[model samples]
Target: MDTPTEVLHRVFGYDSFRAGQQEIIEHVVAGGDALVLMPTGGGKSLCYQIPALVRPGVGVVVSPLIALMQDQVDALTALGVRAGFLNSTQDFAERQQVESAFLAGELDLLYLAPERLRVEATVRLLAKGEISVFAIDEAHCVSQWGHDFRPDYLALSELRELWPEVPRIALTATATPATHAEISSRLGLDGARHFVASFDRPNIQYRIAPKSEPKRQLLEFLRTEHQGDAGIVYCMSRASVEKIAAFLVDNGVDAVPYHAGLDSRTRAAHQAQFLREEGLVVVATIAFGMGIDKPDVRFVAHLDLPKSVEGYYQETGRAGRDGLPATAWMAYGLQDVVQQRKLLTEGDEAHRRRQALHLDAMLALCETVGCRRVMLLDYFGQQGSEPCGNCDTCQAPPESWDGTVPAQKVLSAVLRLKRERRQKFGVGQIVDILLGKQTAKVLQHGHESLTVFGVGTELGNAEWHGVVRQLLAQGLLAVEADYGALVLTDASGDVLRGQRQVPLRRDAPRPLRAKTAAAAKSRPAAELPQEAAPVFERLRAWRAATAKEQGVPAYVIFHDSTLREIATLAPSTLEELATVNGVGENKLAKYGEQVLEALTA
Candidate 1:
C-alpha cells in the first residue's frame, strides 16, 4: 500500500502538507479526534482531505453552508477525486444516486449538513457501518456566544455520543477566547489535540477609512489601487448592496450583487460569473458570502463595517488566497456603530453579549495604528515579527492629534440636549448643536449661550465627527436604545475633563476611484496575462511535479518568490539569472538548470 505522503501527490496535486497540516493529518490518520483553529487561507481543508483519501472507510464532512458544499464538491470532481455532496440543492434522483454510491463504496468522501447528520436515519446508517472520520466544518457556530452562532449547531456534540470511536475533527477560520472554550465543550472533546495554525498572512495589506461617499471611494480604489482584479464588496443592508453594485456598473465596473432577497438561480449565476470572469466585483451583504473559494481575489472592500472582528478577518482573508499580494479595504463610521448596536440590542441577552465583544474587536481593528497584519494576527492567536509594509498605515502612516477638546464638546452636547442616554446623533446635527447653530434644538433648549456650545469650533467638522466615532467605540458615548439619541456614559467624565488623551488616527476615508476606473470594465476580471502569470504558475506546477518525484517540500525545490522572479526574468543561462534577488548562491547552483529548461520548454 502507498503511504499517506504518496497519496498526497497521487490523489491530490499537492506535493506535501503545509507547516502544521501534516501533523494534524497524521493524528487523524492515527484515528484521533482533533479540534483545529486555522486561519483563512491557512490550508485547513487539506488537513482532513488527504487523510480521508488515505485512511479506511468513507469520510463524512458536515458543513453548514450549501453553497460551499457545491463549490467544494465541484473542485474535487474536477480533480478526479471520488467526492460528492448531499444537500437540499440536489434533487431526489440525484440524492438517490449519491446514496447508492456511498453504500457501494464508490465515493471516498461525502459532504453533509448539520441537519442531515442529526437525523435518526443518518445516525443509524453511520452506526451500522464503519466511517473514517466525522469532520465538522465551521465548528465555532456551535458556541452560543460566538459571532457566527447557529441554534442548530448547539446539538453537534451528539456526534461524540453517536460515534465515540469513529474519530472527529472540528475546524473554523476564526475563534476568540470564549468561542474556543465553548467549541471544545460543545464538540464533546474530552481530551483532543488542539492544532492552531498562525493567522498571519503578510501578503495582504490591511486598511480602514471612515465612511464618506463610499461608492466614490470604492470606484477610486477599483480604478487605481486594484484595477482589473477579483474582489468582494460587503454592505450592511440589501439596498446598499444593490445600490453599490448598480453604481459600480453605471460608473464602468461589471459588478453584481448577492443577498438572500435574490432568487437562488440569480445568486448562482452571479457567483458563477465572478468565479469565471476577471475583474468582476461582487457587492454582497454579510449573508451572501460564507465559503466562497475563489483563489486570486486581489482585494476585498467593505462599504460598511462588519458586526465583529471575526467576521472582518474571515471576509478579508478571502483576498490573496493564492499567497499573492492583496488589499483589505473598509469604510467605517459612527453610523455603522449605531446600526450594529441596534442589531445587538434587538436580539436576546446572550446574543447581545457576543455582539458587544464583536463590536469591541471591530473597534480595535479600526483604531489600531501599529502593524495591521500583526494586530489582525494577534486577534487570531498568531504573532508576527514585523509589520507588513503594504498596509495603508504601514505604507502611508496617518498623523493624529490630541482629541481631548473634541471629546469634551461631544460629551457636553449630549448632556445639554436633556436627552435620554441612547439616541443617535448624525454628524450634521451633532456639529450644528456643538457650534450653537440655533437651528431649532438649540433655540428650543436655550443652550446657544452655554459654554459647551461653539467651544468646539477649534476642530473642523470632520475632526469632530471622527472624535464622536472614537468616543463611541471607547464606550464613553452611548445612544439610547429606545429613542436613538446620543448620551454620555459614566466613563465619559474622565475623557471629557482633560483626564485622557484620546488616541485618534487621522480621520481618513478610502480614496476615490480615478476617471480611468471604468476602463477595466471592458476586459475579463479573473484571467491574468498568459505570458508571465502562466509562466509563474508553470514554475509552481513544475515545483509540485518535481517535488513529488523527490520526497521534499516544494520550497526545497524552489520557493514561490524565487519561481515568481524566475518567471519574470526567464533567463536562458545560469550567469544572467545570478542577478535575480531570490536566486541566491545555493538555489542558483541547485535548481537553476532545470528551472531554465522548464521556462524555455
Candidate 2:
C-alpha cells in the first residue's frame, strides 16, 4: 500500500492534506472505522477516498443519488483510476462490467446504492472477493430522524455483519445530536474515529421576507444582486414549480421547472441544461435537486419555507458550493405554514411529529435576530470563532422599535374587521383600511369609518408590511382559514389585548416594487480568482470525464482551481503539476502522464 501522502498525489491530487484529513485517513487505513461530519465543500470525500486507495482491495462507496454517483465516477476516471457503479440507472451491460471489474480486481472504487449492496449477486461477489472498505456518503440518510430518510439505507447495518473486517466511514454535510447518535446506532459505527469539520459557510447571505407579490421581490433580487450566477428556486408543489418557472421566463429570466410530474427524460434534459448553462435559475420542488452535482450555484431562493431546518440547510447549501459569495433568500407567509401543516397531517402519525419538529426549526431560522451565520453554526453544534460578515444583518443592521403600539393597531384592526366583515383581510387591504387609503373598495365597505383605519398611517406601508410579514413568519397569522387572508394568531390575540409586547424589526419599506436598477459600483475591481480564469472551465470538464472513468468525486482528480492552474501553466510534466497548488507528490507519480498528455497535446 502506498503511503497516505503517495495516495494523495497518485490517486487524488493534493499537495498536503487539510487539518485532520491524514489522521482520519490513517485511522481508516489501519482498519479502524470513521464517522465524518463535514459541511458542504469541506473535502469530506477525501477521508474515505484516500483510504480506499491505500487499502488492500476494491473500495465500495454507497451514494444515495444517481447524479452524485455519476459525477463522482466521472471525476475519478478523469484521473485514470478505474472506477464503476451498479445502480438502477445502469444498463445490464454496464452492471455486468462493474461486476467484471470487481472480480478482476481492476476497480479501485465501486459505487452502489444500499439496495444494490443487499442483492444476492452483490453479496456473493463480496463473499468471493477481497473487500477493503465501505464508504457511505450522505450518511445521515441512515438515521430515521434525518430529514431525508430512505428505507434502503436502514439495510446498510447488514454491512457491519457482512464484512466486519472492512473499515466503515459515514459522511454527510449536516447532522445534529439526535441525528449523530442515530447515525452511530444505525450504522453500528459507535466509537469510530469521528472528524467534525467547521460547518460555517461565510459565503452565503441569509434574508427572509413575507410572501406578498413575492414574484416581484424575486425578480428584483435576480436583477439587482445576482444577475449571472446559477441559482435554484424551490417551491412546495410541482404546480407551483411550473407557475414560477413560467413567471420567471415571462420576466426575461432563463428558467426551467423540474419535478416528479414531468417525464423522466424531460427532467433529465432540464437538469443537464442547467448544469451546462450559466445564469440559469431552476424552479423545482423537493422532488428535485437531491444528489445534484452542479457546483457554483450562486443562490437558493425559497418561494416557500422548506419542510425542516435540515432540509432547508441542505437545499440552501447547494449555493456557493465553490465558496464564492451566494445568498439564501426566503419569501414565506402564513399560507405556507398552513399548507405544510396540512400536508404533514395527511401523513402517518410518526411522520406528522417529524414534520412538526422540522417546521419548528424552520420557523426559528426565519425569525432569528442574532448573526445568522452564528445561529446556523450553532445549529450543527459548531462554535464559529467569528461572525460571518456577509449576511444581511451583518451588511445593514436592522432597525428595531418598541412596535408595541403599531402591533396593537394592526391586531386590533384584525379583531374588529373579523367581528364586522366576518372576513379576513389581506395585509394590503387591511393596511389600506388602517392607513385610510381612499379606494372604491374602501368606500363600498366604508372601512375608513373605523377607528383603526387611520391609526397605522403614521407607519409607512413598508414598515407595516414588515410587521405583518414578521407576524406571519412567527406563526401569529393563519392564512388557510382566512382563505389567503391574514388574521391574528392566538399570540396575536393576546398581544392585541395588551397581554404581550411584540419586538419587531419595525422599519421596512411600505411596499416593494420593481426596484430601479441602481448600481453602487465597487470602488476597485476585484482581482481574478486565485486559480487561472477562463481556461479553468475546460480543466473541470476534463477532470469530470476522468473522475467518471474512476468513479470518484471530481475533486479527487483535481479541484477546479487546481485544474485552472494546469490550464494556465499548461503543466507538461510531473514537476510542473507538483508546483500547482494542492498538487502533491502522490498525485504527480500516478497521473502525471495523463495530465501532461492532455495539456501538452
* TM-score of each prediction: 0.84, 0.83
Evaluated against the true structure, the overall lDDT of model 1 is 0.75
Per-residue lDDT of candidate 1, residues 1-601 (tens digit) = 5567766655453456678988998899998999998877788887888778788888999888886676677556544568888888889899888887888788888899888876777677666556778889888888875667787777788877777777899999888767788899888874999988777777677878767787887887788766767799999889999999999999988899999899999988888677655468999988766677666687899988887788888888888876876778898887787666656676778667867887888887787777677778777666655777767677666667676767777887777655433334555677776765778865765667666677777777777777877887878887667656677788888876778777677743444233244443322222444577778767767876776565343444544555666777778888867656445444566577888888877
**What are the per-residue Cα lDDT tens digits for candidate 2 across 136-156?**
989999877788898888889
Clashes of each: 18, 26
Q: Which run of 10 residues does model 2 get worst, by summed lDDT?
A: 519-528
**What does the lDDT come to for candidate 2?**
0.75
